[model samples]
Each structure stands twice: as C-alpha cells, then as structure tokens.
Target chain A: MARRSSLASRIFPFVFGLVVGAGVLYFFLPGPPQGGKVQTAQQPGAKPQPGQQGPAQPAGSTLAEVRARGYIQCGVSTGLPGFSNPDDKGNWTGIDVDFCRAVAAAVFGDASKVKYRPLNAKDRFTALQSGEVDLLSRNTTWTMSRDTSLGFDFAGVIYYDGQGFLVKKASGITSAAQLNGATICTQTGTTTELNLADYFRGQNMSYKVLPFEKNEEALSAYDNGRCDAYTTDASGLHAQRLILKTPDDHIVLPEVISKEPLGPLVRQGDPQWEDIVRWTLFALIDAEELGVTSANVDQQMTSASPEVRRLLGTEGKFGEPLGLSNGWAADALRAVGNYGEMFERNVGTKTPLGIPRGLNALWRNGGVMYAPPIR
Target chain B: MRWSWTDPRMRALVWQVAALAATLVTLWYFAAMAHQNLARQHIATGFGFLDNTAGFGVVQTLIPYSEESSYGRAFLVGLCNTLLVAALGTVFAVMLGFVVGVARLSTNWLIARLATVYVETLRNIPLLLQLFFWYFAILQPLPGPRDSLTLLPGIFLSNRGIVMPAVETTPSTAAFVLCLLTAIAAAIFIGRWAKARKLRTGESFPTLIVNAVIIIGLPGLVWLIASAAFALAPPVMGKFNFEGGWRVLPEFLALLLGLTLYTAAFIAEIVRAGIQSVGRGQTEAAHALGLSSGQTLRLVTVPQALRVIVPPLTSQILNLIKNSSLAVAIGYPDLVSVFAGTVLNQTGQAIEVIAITMAVYLIISLAISFAMNLYNARVAIVGR
Candidate 1:
C-alpha cells in the first residue's frame, strides 16, 4: 500500500507538470481560436457624415479622459529648430508647440496643460495610431496616401510650405538644373527625399543622394560641405539657415520643387473629434480674416456684426453642436491670438524663419486660407 | 527527515507546472488582444503583400532587379547582401584572428603589445559606434572626385568608392577555368594515391608540391595555349571611372571593414582559449612520440581544443549574422534595412513587415545551428 501510494504521488506531480506545460503552451501558441472575432467588436462600422467624411467617434465623449490624465498628450518632433525644439531650460517652443498649447487651451482652458512627446518621422504615425498621443502637431506633410490608406485625418494645413534646396555660396550654383551630378544631403523617411527624386528625374538630371536618419545630421553634413546642397521644406531651410555659424555662406536656390501642405494630425475613426479640431483651426483663420486679434477680441466680442458676435460666444451656441462650450474659440484665441498673430509671432517676418505670408494669406488677399462662413 | 509526498522532485515538478500554466494563460490573453486589435484596425495578417511589386529602386544590387519587381525579389536581394557581408566578414575575421591571436602569444614585446591594444580597444567599444566612426568620421571626409586620392596604377579611393582596375573574362577564360577544374580533380586523385603508397610502403611522398604543380601549372599551360589559339579582350580603364570594372561602394567597404575588425577581436579570444585548452601532457606525449612541433599541434592539440571551441564559436557566428542588421545605419540595404525599414514605410504594413523580418532571421539562425550540430556530431568523441 505504501509503495503504491508513493507511486501515485510521483505520477501526480508529473501529471501536474504536464498539465501546466500544456497550459503555458496553449497561452503562447497564438491565443484563442476566436481571436479575429474579438477585433471586429472594437472597430466601428462605416458611416458617412456631413462637413467631413472622416472616421467616426462617440459624440460628447470624455474630455476628462484627456485632462485628468495630467497633460494633453501632444506629439512633437525630436528636434526641429525654430518649429519644435527645447530651449536652454528644456522647455519646448515653436510654431508647432503653440498649436499643441492651443489645443490644450480649447480643451482644458489652460495652454500649459500639455505633455510634449518627441517623435521621429518614422515613428510619428505609429505613435498616433497606437494612441500614444492625443494629437500630432509635428511638421508632418498631408498627402492622399497618409490620409486615406494610413487611416489618419489631417486637421487642416497649419503651414503652407514648398520643397527648396540650399547650397553653399562658394558652389556658385544658381539653379537646381546646374546641380546635376552633385551630391545632395537629405533626411530619409520624408516627402523631401521623394520630391528630390521626382524633381531631378523630371529634369533628367542624375544626382547622388546622401541620406541621414535625422534632419540635424543632414543639415550638419551640408554645413560641413559633405554634400553640395541640402533639400527640405523651404520653412525648414529658413529655420535651419539661422543656426548656421556662417549663415551668409549658404543661400537657398530659387527653385521650389514640390508643394508640402503641413498640418497637425489625429488618428482615424474619430470624426467628432476631427471636426472639432478642424473647425478650431478654421475659426482661428476666420478670426484673423475678420480682423479679430487677441488685443481687440474683447471689443470685437460686442461688435454689431453677427459673425464676430457668433465667434466670440456673445451671440451664438456654435460650440455646443461640436460638443464644446460656447467659449472654446474665445478661450483658444485669448490663449494664442488668431492665425495671423500666431504666424508672425512664431515663424513669420519677426521670427528668424522670416517666412513671408505668400500662400498663407487670407482668401480676400488672393491666398488660400479660406474658412467656411460662421452661419 | 524521511521523504514524504513533499519530496524535492515532486515539489520541483509541481512548481514548474504551475509556472508553465500561468505563463501560458498570460500569453493567450496577449495574443487574443493583439488579434482582436489588428482585426479591428482592418490590417491584413497574411503574407499576400509579398507578391506586390516594390515601387522603390535599390542603389546597388547583385541580381537583376527593378522597381516593378515583387517584394519577394527585394527580400531575396536583401538576404543575398546579408549573406555576402557575413561570408566576406567571416573569411577576413578568421585570417585576422589567427594573426592577432598568435601575436598575442608572441615573443616580440612591441608586436604583442600592439595586438593586445588592438583587441582591448576594439572589443570594448560597441560595434554600431565603430561602424559609425568608420563610415561618417573616416570615409565621409574623403575628398570629392575632383581631388580623389589616387593609388598605385589605375586605382582610386574617394568618398564615392574604391575604383580598381578589373579583369574581363573572354571566351578563352572559360576554357582556362575548365582546364583548372580538370587539373584540380586529377591532383586530388594523385594525392589519394600518393597517401596510400606512403602508408602501405612506409615511404613518404611530397603530395603538396605535386598537387600545386598539377593544379596551378596545368591551368596556366591551358590558358597560354588558349590565348595563342584565340584573340581575347582585356578590360581597359575609361574616363571618369573604370568603365567595365567592378567598383565597391564606400558604404559597403566601411560596413565590411567594421564588421571584420570588430568580429576578429572576439574570434581571437576564442582561438586563444581554444589553443590553451589542450593540456601540457598532450604536447609532451606528442614530443615523446617524436613528432615535430607543427605535427604535434596538428595531430594532438587542435582535435581536442576544437571540441571546446566550436560551440561558443557557433554562437559568435550567429551574432555576426544578426549584427549585420546594423547595415541600415550606414545605408547598406541588408534584410532589416531594406525589408523592415523601407518596405514597411512604403507599404504601411508595420506588423507584417516586422513579422516577416523576424521569421527570416529566426530561420537563418536555426539553419546555422542545424549545420553546426551536424559538424559537431561528426567530430564528437565516441563512448568506450
């Protein structure tokens, strides 16, 4: 009986081990059989909406879900000078930084209520899709592929840019046509690299590309004369040109190769949120067009014009339809002025970027910054 | 104390089973979550995209490839480049390792110190940093083609690459290669016969001298006869760059040099340990048997030391294979760089691209292990 009992004990543990191993194997071996079924439950069904056919999200959904989380999760670049870079005190400041603050102001009514997450170009999309950031205000280009295929909604163009090339003055090269057979330094995983190829190929010019993982590396390479020229967004070139030890030693070529409509982005499947963000930008543009600066916003709030009164929360409930308070636009404007004010303060004539308001001007001035009428 | 139901083995088995079960449950939950999430996102989970044409062009390729070629072909190109780098790196590393390893045990103090310094300095730093130093700091600083550094004869080294005079094979060269193969086969047969005669009659034959003469001399004779019979075209240098000659890009050279030098440091340590593992008694016994130092090493030391060296050596080889992934940092389109980075961005299928890349690496690693196992089994000591 004792021998039999001992044998039973031995077999019991062995059996237990086998069972446990099987259990572990089961878990490790690609999950449950109904795995695919679980996924469909989370994805929303297709639906069309007016004003924007963007991805869908719940109406009046949790804003506290963003704020009680401490800071408004804002994605910015790793380091783009003048646009999104840390100051000596490690505080981020730039045109993109202000956009993040503006979004925070619209939500929490406090511009400083933000957590800045720096992301590289390659990781920016995944970061957004994975919901690591609530909004992406990096200097990202808006393209059809990114919008439709990648499942991301662009929140209106914040910066109208075009591709340009910068060469050392010593090279004496006046046109991009003369740059045939020359090596050009450019950042990889960007629209600029593709634009460079397209432009050169169209001109039937053969040039070697020296690609760098970071924009700073490419810029430094160009500065050190490692390549004959550097190419990127004209605004980026302007910003980078300011940091040059010998700024006058280099000059931007006259040719503008490709149009780059830069903007903030949000993940797809959130139309309610997309509309709110999109119109927030439109409101700013409209405010600027209607001559509503932050300094004069209080006076304009009581203006006789129905549109000005409607925008400043004095006359209409426009924000209620978008699941925001009537004062959201007024708060955002107070925090960061109108579009024209933000532009000049951040990257316009007053700033080192000195980007002229060419295509970025209001529609009445023959530019494309047109916002829908505030009904 | 007397053993009971709570015996050590029983306890161990029980604990192991519990741990395994818990791990399995966790894995299942995570897997289910991923599946549900990916499905919800409408991302395709299969390998159908491999059939799609790659829209980008590769700067350098060994095979016929175009922008319209399928992703599978791009994958193949990446794999080929990876293997090419690994193979070339292994050859150079072995040669360098032996020299450095021997020099470490040298009588000349300066030479020994130099080898020591080289090994210590290289082995301590990370391979990626070394690669960057060589590529960016060393190679990128080279003058442009207008002021390219000219080497002896028609060779030049610049930031672009190394341009060397190359030979173009004519029709007669094919005949020469055939003759060379035939000569090598004849030499092998002669060597076997010579070894057999030496063993049977207790007579020595200089097989090495004979084989060299047959293999090299016969091939040279055939080449001369072919050239006399038929006119051949030789490669000539052209303007700007060598027209018909092969040019090695600076990126490739930098990667190759970095991988080889860094890997050689580890290989030297392996070789040193391998040589030292054989006991002094074994060498004394070899000497007692009237064998020369060279013979003693070949017959006694290497066989035993190989048993200890090979397992660790196999791991180092696998490491070199994986470390080749760093080629992305330098713009060499190895598997990870081309497929995972470029292809993933182009296709916007991160999950699929990463999964494929991981699977390819796992397969390569497994194949290496399997081959090494076969070799290990062949050389393993047999039971009494």
Candidate 2:
C-alpha cells in the first residue's frame, strides 16, 4: 500500500504538467482566419460590371490587416524586361513595379513602402491566393476561369497584348502559317501553350511543343537549336529578344494568335481591397486622359475641369469610402506619373524593347484604353 | 470496475489508449481546419478537374497524347516517362555497380585504385549539378542538325538529339518475336534440368554454352529464315530538324546518365561492404576443397553477401525514383513537372493536386519496400 501511494505520487505531477503544457501551447498556436462568413457568388467576367459595389463590411477586412502590417506585398514576375525585371543592384524596375509603387503611394503616401515577391508562372496564382502577396502586379492575363474559379479579381487591363512567334531569321519562316511540323519552345503553366495548340489545330498544321518551367529555359532551348521557334506575348518577345545572344538574328512574326489583356489582380474575398486596387488603376488612366502629369499634378489640381478636380480629389470625397485619404489619386499620380508616362518610360520606342503603344493607346487615339469616369 | 492507478498492466493499457486518442484528435483537427479554410477561401476543391482538357503538349511521351487529351491522360503520360527512366536507371546502375564493386577488390593495384577514384568523385558531387553538367555543358554544345556529326551511315549526333534508323516491322516480325520468346523459355527449363542432373549423377553439364546457344542461335535462325522481315527507315534531314526516324531526346539521356552514375557510386560502396562481410575462412575452405576461384565466389560468397546487400540497395533505388522529380529543372516532363506543376497551376486546385501527387509517391515507395522486404526474407538466414 505504501509503494502504490508512492508510484501514484510520482506520476501525478508529470501528468498534470503535460496537461498544463498542452493548454499553454494550444493558446499560443496561430488560429485560422476568423469570422467564417458565406462568400457572395460573383460572376466570372474579366470586366467589372458597372454599379456593382463591393460588400460594405467584409468579414475579415484586408484593409485593416494591411494597416497593421505596414507595407503591401506585391507579386511580380521572376524577370521580364519591361514588365518586372530587377536591375544589377537588385532594385526592381519595370512598368509593373511602378504600378505596385502607385498602389503603395495611394495607401501609405510613400512609393518605396512596398516589397516585391518575384514569382514564376506556375506559382504566381498560388502565391496570391495564399495571402503571401497583397496584389499580383505580374503580367497575368485576365481570363474568365481565373476571375471566378480561381477566386481572384482582375483590377483592370494594364497592357493590351497578344501572343506571337519568335523565330530565327536564318530559318526564313516569314509567317506563322509556314510553321508546319516545327518544334516550338514555351514556358509551361501559361496561356501561350494553349494558344499555340489552338492556332496549329485551326490552321490544320502540326507542331510539337517543348514546355519549360521558366522563360529563360525555353529561350535557352530555342537558342541551342533544340527548338525551331519560340512563342510568347508579343511585348514579351520584344523584351526577351534584347537578352538573346544575337538580338538581330530573330524576328517576331506578324501574327497575333490570341488576345492577352494583362492586368494586376487580388484575391476575391476582400471586396474593399479589390475596390482600392481597381480605383488606383483607373486613377492612373484617368490622370493620363485628363492631361495630369506627375510634374504638373499640383498645377492641374487648381484647373477648372470638374473631371480633373474630382480625379485629383479636389472636388469630391471619393477616396474616403475606399478607406484612403481624399488626395489618394494625387499621391498615386505623383509617384508613377500618368499611364502614358509609365508606358513610355519602361517599354516605349526609346527603350531597347522599342514597343509601340499600339492597342494600349487611348480610345480617342485609335486604341481602346478607356476607363470609367470617376463620378 | 474502477481503474487501479497502481496496477501495471491496467495502467499501461490506459496510457496507450490515451496516446492513441491524442494522436487521432490532432490529425482530425488539422484535416477539419484545412477543409474549413478551403471553404472560406472560396477556392474550388475537387478531382473533377482531371476530366478537363490539358491543352498543353509534352516533348516526349510513351503513350499516344495530344493537346486535346484530358488532364488524366497527361498524368498517365508523365507517369510512364518517369517509370521508364527509373527502370532503365536501375538496370544500368546495378550492372555497373557490380562490375565496379568487384573491380575495387581486384588483385591489381591500378584497377582497384581506379575503381575507388570513380566512386569517390561521383558520389561527392550533388546530383542536380551533375545533371546540369551532362545536359548544358556536354550536350548543349554539340553541333546543330545542319552540322550534325555523322556517326555512321544512318546515325547522327546533334544538339537536338541522337537520330538513328528505326526498324520498320513486316509480316514475319510476329513470327520472329515468337521464336525469341520460345528460346528464352527453353533456356530457363534447360538450366533447371541441368542443375538436377548434376545433383543426381555428380557430373556437371556445359549449361552456360548450351543455354547461350539456344537464346541467341534460335533468334538468329529465325531471322535468317525470314530475310526481309524488317527494314530500316533512316532519318532524312529536313529544313529545321531531322524527320521520320527514332530520336532520343538529350533531356532524357542527361537525366538517365546522371541518375545511373550517381546511384551506381553508392551501390558500389554497398556491394563492397556486403562482399567483405562474408568470412574469409569460407573462401579458404572452398579453396581447400580444390574449387576454382570463380566457382568459390559463385557458390559461396555471393549468396551470403546478397542478404546484407538487398536492404540498402532498395533504399538507393527508392532515392533514384524520387530524385527523378528534378526532371523539371531540365524539361524532362516527369510526373511532378506535368501533373503537380502545370496542372496545379492551370486549375488552381493546390490542395487536391498536391495531395494526389504525394499519395502517388507514397504508393510507389511502399510497393517497392514491400517487394524488397519479401526478397530480403528469401535470402535471409534460415535456421532450425
């Protein structure tokens, strides 16, 4: 009886300590996102329908979370020249990078308060959906499936692009129709692969595809004579050509296979965050249409035009409802300049890419880049 | 029926049941949390995406596949490619490992030292770097199709791949195949019968030469009977690449070469240790009985060494199969690169896709372990 009492006394503290430790650890462990609410069914469309407002009070507000964590995390491409390539000093420079800065400028009033997460084609969507990035400003195509099924919202089109083929000049393949029984190299997990297949099937031609995980590998395969041609977005072709061994030896065929309305996106549950990203993009476009340049934004603030006054936040309280200061558009414009300025600075004719603003030009200038008026 | 705290048996049972309950609760919590999070995120989660069109092309496929094929078919194609590389790598590694392991124990100092050097040099380097070295440094610099090096009349080596003549089958090809199968079966039967006769009569037959003759001679005789049973279709140079022939891709060759060489080095070490584990007295006993050196090894050392060799050898093979997932780095289109990668990205079904991929690898590894364990039992020390 004494030995039994001693054994019980020995194990009682150990058992009690284990229960106490487990209770403490359970509280310390990070829980899931709070407040489970049913998600409103959204229509799967690239273009946002007019008069469709985001939820007034989100279950878990992304804006409040962003405010708690100071800087917005932006997901960009690993490296695409005029889109989101990092320079030698590791400072990212591209139109996509500038758009990220514009969003940061609007929210925090500081352009440099944003961090970049460079992602590949396969991991871009996963990274955004998992809340690793606040916005995906990468050159992602705005498609129906991505908008609805993937649980994302496309803010607006940043670049009106299309797929094209890049082939060596020595091969003398002048047109895409001539690429029969040819082996083409492209990046996997991208729309380019599907477009190539559809184009070939429609033309009643045959070809083989060598899909690599990254664009650099695909380009390397094409350069090593493993593939007859390379295919990607036409803007991407122009940008990637400059990094080739002999840029002058290749030519992009004059055929646009599919429409690629590249844009920035955010996750769908947080409607307020989506509205903020959408309005920031619209502000840049509206600023360009209203002749509000970054250098002259302060001077144009006092102009007589009500549209410019409203956009510059001089005549309205449009920014407050989206959870920002009244002068949010002014701050965004001051950081990245207008849309035209961004286009010309990164991939315009002056740059090595030398891409002309063809379909990306304003609607009044023989292009279809119109934005909804900020009423 | 009150529980007694001091009763040893009852206490042990209670603790075991409590631990099991804790583990079950933890696992259930994680699963429930994952499902809840997925639902709240509004991300589509299901295996229905397998029926959707893959809409992508793979460079090399063992089965018939096109862009119009479903994602499930693409997964099958990737799986076949992976299995092909793993099987070929295993066969070549085992053969080369045995040779090198035996050579390391050679009487000549030069051969032994050379074998040691080969093992040390290969096993020390990372497998991925070796893959890159074989792929980019060695193969990529080869001449293009226009300037291909003609190895023979119809074989060409280029950066694209190795282009060789393909055998075009004729009407008598099936007869030729049947003859080959019959010879193989006859050889096996003859081998067993010779073993029985040797035990019964105390005299050995020339089983090796006779079995060899049956296997090779029968195939040769059938070919001679049907002279035009097959024709060679040589590759013709086209505008961009060679057309209409068998082309072995450089990516596949690089992966196979890297896997075989790296694994063979480890396998060599295992084999050397296994052989040395056999007592030296056993060899001396066979020698005292006037048995030849070759016969001593075949009759005594190998059977004993196999018991020690198989368990570790199974590990190295499983490592090789898992290492094939690195095919994505060089565009080899293995299962991970195609299904887990491209399919996951397109469908945005991360939970389902990753779970499926992990389950497949688990099944493959378990199957290998089960088979190897059975073989290990067969070679195990059986005592009364």
- DockQ leader: 2
lDDT of each: 0.76, 0.86
- Model 1 alpha-carbon drift over 4 Å, by segment: A1-45, A48-62, A169-172, A178-183, A200-210, A220-228, A242-249, B1-32, B42-46, B201-213, B228-244
Model 2 residue A269 distance off true place after TM-score fit, in angstroms:
1.2
| TM-score of each model, paired residue for residue | 0.85, 0.90
TM-score winner among the candidates?
Answer: 2
True contacts kept of each: 0.11, 0.44
> Candidate 2, residues A1-375: lDDT per residue as tens digits?
123253465455446445533432332234332333333344644333323323432533677777789989999999999999998989998999999999999999899999999999999999988889999999999998888788788999999999999999999999999999898989988988888989998998888888888889889888878888999999999999888999999999999999999999998767678889999999999899999999999999999999999999999899998999989999999999999999999999999889989999999998889999999
Cand. 1 TM to true fold: 0.85
A66-97 per-residue lDDT for model 1 (tens digits): 75686688899987776788888889988788
For each candidate in turn, the interface RMSD (Å) is 8.3, 10.0
lDDT of 2 at A271: 69
